[model samples]
Target: MGTGNADADAVLRILVVEDEALIALELECLLDDLGHVTVGVAGNATEAIAMGRSTAPDVALVDIHLVDGPTGIEVARALSADRRTTVVFMTANAKRIPADFAGAIGVIAKPYSERVVASTLDYVADRRAGRDGPACPDGFWPAPV
Candidate 1:
């Protein structure tokens, strides 16, 4: 099984699918701090779908609500077609998620803390490392006050 460091290899290319510009930028910055590369940022499902096909990122962070017709769940399903890519949903709505997205790494609730985001990323990385069980890396903290 691959280790967390193995998952962090290859620049950890990622795609951010969000309609809100500020949130997108925030996520991009966070990914940057983690040493991950943001290959593409899309405002809606259609654009996200296109980017997914072209960029082929190692992971995709998608917001549930987008400008385009389909929700982020739709985009997640589309991007996840490539087994190499991990799909993570970002939204304030944590009550429920589509049944089709059962395979997603996890949901990152909005108004997200840096700790939440970091933990989510670490979890995804661990899963990619072939660890079936949940694993939360140390040193995560909520967004600064």
Candidate 2:
């Protein structure tokens, strides 16, 4: 729901930094369904940085493991250089993300569902709006009422 780069009410231009083709495709579809646009998909650190520069996405959904290697964290670090970009790590091994990595906004575990994705986005929106009360504990977003 929230990985793409979007303002509060605008369609987000998203940059998907996942190496898996199928997962990347599914993410694109889900973002589109949520009224976001997939600006590009990257499979490695190099590609991710390139896409970030060209697309200037509002947010990036990055996987910790990338095509080049375990460089997802590197990608996130690089993308965060842009003040307008928010980085969210998405990986099966969420434990890899550092507890105090300021470059990232948050993370969501892999094998997520449609509703989870939607809720995650909503949570990100809250974060951008400065209403994110606390760091989401384990990314558990309550079901929308």
Candidate 3:
């Protein structure tokens, strides 16, 4: 885990940006199980940006594609202007991630299992806590061991 003194149970406010309802709910459940708080869910980039501005979540889990014209990276860039918001991309098309988003804290490929999600959450939490340098969680791109 990344270095930090913050409690693992810390309630991190989070925003979920995904076009699919089922996936959004699943992500919410995963966040809940991790003791994180889901502040908002957006099906498109527009709403995601709006929610990010309004809620100012600690982190945002964004999918590459949204219902609207702008992509998740676009929303991340806009919302991240505050610099306090951490961004993670959850997408099947890892290769499609914007070049600039390579600087994001982490990326989780789709078809992720419970373990993968958990590890990603740990990585994010650690990053927020200032424990480890921002990097995609180990094994995030590979199938769960």
RMSD to truth, every model: 6.3, 5.1, 4.9
Query: Clashes in model 1: which pairs?
Result: none
Candidate 3 lands at a TM-score of: 0.82
Candidate lDDT scores, in order, read 0.73, 0.77, 0.75
Compose the digit string of candidate 1's lDDT tens values, residues 20-113.
8988898888777776789999998888989999989888987887896447777888888888788877777645566556456667777777
Cα-based RMSD of candidate 1: 6.3
lDDT of 3 at 5: 21
- Which window of ten consecutive residues has the lowest lDDT sum in model 3? 1-10
Q: Write the per-residue lDDT of candidate 3 for residues 1-145, one digit (tens) a residue.
A: 2232247545588899999999999888877777778999999987988998899888888888789744877887877776778787888777777656744555787877767777777676766677757566565652222
- How far residue 129's Cα lies from its native spot in candidate 1, in Å, is 2.5
TM-score of 1: 0.80
- Candidate ranking under TM-score, highest first, comes to 3, 2, 1
TM-score of each: 0.80, 0.81, 0.82
lDDT of 2 by residue, 32-113 (tens): 8887778899999998998999888888988999988889988998999998787878888676876554388767778777
Q: What clash count goes with each model?
A: 0, 2, 1
